[model samples]
Target chain A: MTTTASAPGRPAPVKPGRPLRIRRRMTPRRAGSIALKTLVIGFLLAITVLPLIWLLLGSLKTQTEWLNSPSWALPENFLNFENYQVAWVDGDIGRYILNSALATFPSLALIVVLGVAAGFALEVLVWKGRGGVLLLFLAGIMVPGQMILLPLFSAYFQTHLTGTIWPLILTYTATGLPLTVFMMATYFRAVPREIFEAAAIDGASIYRSFLSIAFPMVRNAVFTVALVQFFFIWNDLLIALTFTSVGDFQTIQVGLLNFTGQFGQVQYGPTFAAICINVVGILVLYLFLNQRVMRGLTAGSVKG
Target chain B: MNNVFGNKRAVLVFVGPALLIYTVIMLVPVLWSLGYTLFTGSVITGFEFSGFDNFAKLFSDPKVGEALLFTLKYAVILTVGQVLVGYALSLLYVFWLRKASSLVRTLVFFPIVLPTVAVSLLFQKMFEVAPQNGIVNEFINFFGLPSVDWFGSPDTAFLVLVIMDIWRSMGFYAVLLYAGLLDIPEEVMESARLDGAGGWTLIRRIVIPMSLPVLLSSIIFSINGTLKVFDSVLALTNGGPGSSTTPLTLLMFRTAFSYGDYGYGSTIALLLTVICLLVTVFIFRSSRRDLTKG
Candidate 1:
């Protein structure tokens, strides 16, 4: 964008200008620097990914091979994928994944819907208590999640939401509400109210205007919120542990945690295979939606 | 002009559902938890008025004090570690790797989405030294060094906890700080370079001062998050090595569930809540001053 500052007449044609001079002077030193940088980056990438790769490879190896050999040892049976089967059947990660999906998807949808509406209300519509309501949510964003656990547990049992996905869903949505509202509100505020006003003058109701104008304007934010909330719910362990305690009802996290205790000592292959089962979904989502995930994760910091 | 947008009912219509759910699930629970601090028993054991009894216990209990001390230590160490590693990674991103680091950044951030339980289990297996050969031990053996019991003692276990945490979330802070670094306009950087500010000096005098707000925010975020940490530690060591790794949250959780002492558990939770709130406010206030100065 700023290349316009150094246009054709500025300095390019005279005495091989500053940029060209720097390039000419940079061959040897730049090569060394580039090599150094690549090394550092490679080291970092290894730290980030080598353990995960080892986890995958280790899972493919049998328990005896995994323990007897060093961590870096390659699996003897690349064709044998029995560990995943064991993790799914014996560890019951399949059930847990199903339970987690049941908990995450519906709540994520509800949060998006509720959050978008609240954002429109506070950020677009002229309401008397907008600041008060916004303040409520801003405060909600800061509320330490664990602090609400005991009372939520109390309510969970009373309402019969415990031992099922309902309590986890409710907890996720509530905990996710503040950020959802805040992010969506920021998106809504950026939207031009004049469009909504024009729609109102055209005999369209405010609800209709929102559906037609403001909602479309804030679709990116809605998607961002959905992705972020899904990540939170799926990654959550505290609420899942407290609320979904039944063996059949546990989410992937709780299931994986319990399964670890049972198998971590001796059954390294299946244990890690179960861990991979849980992570693969998130990893795949991350690969496909890396940019959106980056933007959504960083969005919180910007708004805050 | 009589318009549908002019009505207050629209406000309620838009905001009501979210507020209702948030209030029922979050607001009410917070208040209920506060009230629970004054009671002395559980659902089955019945309740009794225990005025200041839980608070009194919180102070006298040596375990509570020990847990508090550990929580503070953990918060300070982990927060600092995260900030340093993140800052370095951000510098690497902007100054060196540029677009080449995109794949690396994605890989780094991948762990942030993995369940804490899974990562902790991974680390637990990796660091295991006794009874069987885990990865870390395997690595040490490959180098001709004797195996060290990583989690057999309090100090090593706590160190592993700290290292695992930094490994898991360092990417988040790095990416966050990198975004902040990118926000420094290219023009300012070029001018700084032109003015003979090179490398560390430029970063020290220019970037640090410029990105103070984001830096402070990241610090506060890490501190508050670490202060209330439960699941990661629970999954990692379950506050093991003879309660050496036990944080305040774990202590509170066990008190409520394992011991069925709801009142005392709630009291510990309230302490954690107050600490987190105080950190948030303090850092927020401090950042406001710094931000306004810019």
Candidate 2:
């Protein structure tokens, strides 16, 4: 999985007979260089990691402590799950998480299935006017969500789907498709056409060949596309905000926004805790899928 | 093979659902949005064709002008920060850290996946001034300086917004440009080094030109993404401090949804679309011209 993820634009293999450069002896210049590198790396690490740690610590603190204590102070008790309980129950973060999942997962499934099919037809299958069709899809990528927001809302309002998760699912899937199809087409184009031809000669149906041959060949692309779209759908605020009303099918982001407005001033601990809940959910997923996520994101941008 | 693969029915099966959904949900709404610019009022009030009145109103609206200026300023600053910082980090990853940069890259990239609301809350607390001093104020107090209200004024709020966004996104750009850097053959660096090209000279003459395509891609990607800067600003500032920080998207949302003025909102949306298209074309044309010149 890792190998395939990094396959696109992977560094070239070193040439044979290339002389390996010897490391220079420890000198003042080298020492200064190392020192400068250490300073820069350390600064980057500190800026990136410290706020998160501070947030974690803040979440563990009691409300009184959060209000009175210095921001950098450690929590008096690390075992205080009181804020977590308040956040999960009172803040209704769990419901928002479920709502986000409800919107995100179905969107991912649609994007992948539809995207792969469209990509395969556009790139792999012998077809006429695929170029024009592909360009149409690609052009959708440039259309800002703002351009479609008012119309979508108006349409959803008329259809009486304004407060449901349907709008989010449909819009996410549709907007996500342009990139998904483009990336999948890029991936599917790399697969040899002869294999699909061979399968057809062996009496395989188009669906059969796509399912058995093309899909497996581009499994990495599927994962890449899925992960990329997962981040997008999961972290989206605009479509989610526009489609769903407050407290009814509101995704985690909108919920968090309302949560902050409600509790941000008076209840610092639970508010931070609520924010932590959102961050921790994404962090857990990212930890598990970081490599794939990184590779997938880079592959799309670098190659596309 | 030709008969089976080239079947029109199979092609429709493959492409029908996606195209249908894309057209209905995406493409149609865009055209519809353009059409709405000719009408006034929301669905509840019933849209009446006013025929270019929205355009006339859009040109004269002072708030629209403010939002446009803010949007352009925000996009330009954020794009530069995102791409430049990302390029610098990528350079650091390739040249300085090299084989040992993966962990740093991963750590830095963590924030990119974080939800915007969560990051905004964290930044709010970090820079909070009213209820109690946050960490930033704590540090200032430690230095015997007065606590700064980071979000109190428009300038400071915008500053915080810029910092938060750059911090959140630079890592992704780093990894992006890093991928491009990897594709630069090691032999090129080796040969360049052998010719006494070191430090900025090697980067200026070799690395920059070699990685120009990805850099250009990053610039375009960053600019377009920034120009559509709805979520981050929405979450961070909510275009507060008297709408000084409001981008066109948020204003459009407010106009259409909050104020029930769909026609003017769509006009604003059209303006944004035109700006994005113009910027993209400008970048592409200039880059192509540069490529030819070189």
Candidate 3:
């Protein structure tokens, strides 16, 4: 076999004598390759889907059925709402979900507004210390949340912000900024400088150009940042666990942990039901926006 | 354009709010935590200065050693699994599935968005060997193997944690690396195929070298992430049957919050930060050397 180095950005010389194959010819080797690929992919699909199915089936079962039945056994009634009611009411999952939304949306808004503005200015405008500022934000990404947990918790406690959603909102927004601003800067940098110049020549102020021209151009980046941060803040447990002490202020992940600790053993059905609620909430969002979610989440890492 | 864009007030308006918030909430706390390393008490008892005592305690503390060992072991195993499995899956997506891979990608990526606590609960039930065997054990029995009590021991519990976390996160790396793989020009692949480079040869010679940048980035990203793992392990094992599965982050959390040893906890936090920084620098240095040599 010939080994050839195909470095990117250098065009590989095409051999003139070789005919472009329009279709792959079937052979036993190819057939075996196809079989192996299918088997492996099928196994991956099963592993990914089966546990979620188990959760769904378990959620619908009665306690006796859940305990005694085979692990894969389907629930007798698929429409069972009893566990759902128990989880929603007794577990207070609904309230926790609302609290999660309360914390997430406001923080997301702040991250976007601030990230976009900073990203725009840092990348588009003439500024002296922009590189230093960007470096500062980038460095924040490496600081483990562990480092901040103790001090932030104490600060929040002293300021009487421990029991409220402010801690969650503030922490998420602040932590979310580095990546958001970095991503938005990347997006803004891709916009040609001439567009901003044209806007300036049209007598548009910096704010006016940013609001009308630059912002609309990077709406996709905004969406990406918002969606990524939404999932992050929503799925977070550590900060939520640390900051919110009052039951009324707890986010869904924290609430789920507490609910499972309390009801997981004796009430398997409702426990599974509670997990299913959180899963389904995210599953709906993922299904609706999986493409963008996938793109946004990968955008920052893959670009490097 | 320079005059319009260079207004100092506009620049401040654009950048100051984020800078201020990030400084106050994120940056200041890191400095504050660094300062806390010198003091030796929680807020309740009031801090007393004990210069470098916490650092002294960190070296001799057996629990810290065990937690550090667990964290390193977990990070190594999980990073390998996440990156290798993800790379393999991305190869499938690009080479085999191609345009038809989106549905499978979507299914695989589903778990990344699910709350870690929720997924941990599901895994706990799936591996339960107590009152009744979970599906895993049921499968083991189907093959005439004895049911394993997965969480009954530290080793088995660690295995379960690794499997659950890899399942949850490999999709993310797959997606990340998939985007990188997609950047390989079609002509380069076609040319390689013409030269009789197939399968492993094609990937090793062309694809791997071309995608090394993203692959290395993925490795760094995965390593740093696995190093700081807290939520998944917390929800899954809560530091486990004998504190055997506890990572540094969890140890730090318990030290500060539960044990009220803020100074020592901050020291632990500092250790983690240094480890992450070293790992990143090491990878970059090594990769840079490789690039130059190649």
State which candidate has the highest DockQ.
2
What tens digits encode model 1's per-residue C-alpha lDDT throughout A159-276?
Answer: 7766766888788898898999998888877777778778877888888888888888878778878998888888888888888765367888888888856664668789889888
Residue pairs in steric clash, candidate 3? Answer: none
Worst 10 residues of 2 chain B by lDDT: B1-10
lDDT of 3 by residue, B1-294 (tens): 679988889999999999999999999999999999999889767889999999999999999999999999999999999999999989989988888788889889889889999999889889988787788998999999999999999999999999999999888889889988999998999889889999899999999999999899999998999999999899888898989999999999999888898988999999999999999999999999999999
Residues B1-294 of candidate 1 have per-residue lDDT tens digits of 244665788888889999999999999988988999999887657778899989988999999999999999999999999999989889888887888888888878778877888899889888887566777887788799998888888999998998899999889888999999999988888889889999999999899988887888899888988998888899999999889999998998899888888889889988998998888888789878867886
lDDT of 2 by residue, B1-294 (tens): 678889889899999999999999999999999999999999889989999999889889999999999999999999999999999999999988989899999999989889887898899889988788899999999999999988879999999999999999999999999989989998898899999999999999999999999999999988888889988888888899889999999999999889999998999999999999999999999999999999
DockQ of 1: 0.69
Q: iRMS of every model, one decimal?
A: 1.7, 1.1, 1.3
Ranking by TM-score: 2, 3, 1
In model 1, what is the error at residue A2, expressed in angstroms?
Answer: 34
lDDT of 1 at B102: 86
Docking class of predicted structure 1: medium
- Alpha-carbon RMSD, each predicted model: 4.1, 7.0, 5.5
Report fnat, model 3: 0.84
Fnat for the candidates in order: 0.69, 0.78, 0.84
lDDT of 3 by residue, A249-298 (tens): 99999988888667756588898899999999899888889999988888
lDDT string, candidate 2, A1-304, tens digits: 7777886678666677676656799999999999998998899999999999999999999978877778789999999989999999989999999999999999999999999999999997778899999999989988989899889888888898878889999999999999999999998888888898889889999999989999999998798899999988888998888888633899999998988666746688888889898888889988898999888877766544
Candidate 1 residues lying further than 4 Å off, grouped into runs, are A1-21, A25-29, A263-265, A302-304, B287-294
TM-score for chain B of each model, two decimals: 0.95, 0.98, 0.98
For each candidate, what is the lDDT? Answer: 0.85, 0.90, 0.90
